[model samples]
Target: MKSHYSDAPKAQPILRHTLSVLVDNEPGVLARVVGLFSGRGYNIESLTVSETEHEQHVSRITIVTAGTDQVIEQIRHQLERLVPVHRVTDLTVQGESIERELALVKVAGKGEARVEALRLASAFGARTLDATVTSFVFELTGSSEEIERFLRLMGEVGLVEVSRTGIAAMARGAETI
Candidate 1:
């Protein structure tokens, strides 16, 4: 029997990517950008945006998502067509970059649990921002995985709440994304 050329839809391997977008810092710009993803059924795992060039009135948005190569390309292309979008850079493919996330983790415990929480936080370099007799609010800044691990440990102790600022990413050197 001759082997047939496969015509089946091959499964696409999902890849995690980080994208940086530069856009005009104007009203409704963020909403429209987010709308594009929501309307298209694209999932954004993490999103963070801020005005990077104050004088130029331009904002930078960092988005972390997982998708197939085709989907990633489509998302980038669509983003470029947005009215206020000036640039779309996939930092994951552009070379070395630095990515970080900030999270405030609240742990509520007492006695041994509290002691363990402090011990774990110390090892992770988590700083206690606020503390009372029965609880502690910790500020942790690191890669997303690091934050996730810390939160998981916190849960074993007394993880109560978590507020994350998402990912803030940039090129390693003089390059801008």
Candidate 2:
């Protein structure tokens, strides 16, 4: 006998989404926004916030998270209900968008290892920000996946430390949010 629900489709797949939130650049606003995620047990993969309109005291926050469609919609609705929130846009689903992240990587090596590191960094278009006999600092900017690949390769050479500025995303066309 066929089960009644056997032909139903599988559960929705979880997907990574980038959200752009415009809000008032007032103290505690960021805290409140972050609190919502924490309170709900949602995970934030990357978060970047900066004041975009100094005169208007408006800020833009770019948040990257992963969840099912329903969960993402719930988060968006909740954010839209916030007092200071001016706009909330899901860049990932809204249309074409560009996302970039910057990372400062420090590698310590010598001899062949140092040479290989320099070569790999050059091939990856990473700039040599600082260099010493024992170590070097490289700066790289690209998509999250690109940065991850660069870091993984660097680890094989001599990655010592890294500092990443979370993703900054914007829509491609004239549509503003």
Q: Write the per-residue lDDT of candidate 2 for residues 1-177, one digit (tens) a residue.
A: 889898898899999999999999999999999999999999999999999999999999999999999999999999999999999999999988999999999999999999999999999999999999999999999999999999999999999999999999999988686
RMSD vs true structure, all candidates: 1.3, 0.9
In candidate 2 the C-alpha lDDT for residue 171 amounts to 96
TM-score of each: 0.95, 0.97
In order, what lDDT does every prediction score? 0.95, 0.97
User: After aligning candidate 2 to the native by TM-score, how far in Å is the CA of 57 from where it should be?
Assistant: 0.6
Question: Model 1, 136: alpha-carbon shift in Å?
Answer: 0.3
Off by over 4 Å in 2: 7-9
Q: What is the lDDT for 125 in model 1?
A: 99
lDDT for residue 31 in candidate 2, whole number 0-100: 98
- Model 1 lDDT per residue over 1-177, tens place: 655657668899999999999999999999998899999999999999999999999999999988999999999999999999999999998998899999999999999999999999999999999999999999999999999999999999999999999999998987555
Among these predictions, the greatest lDDT belongs to 2
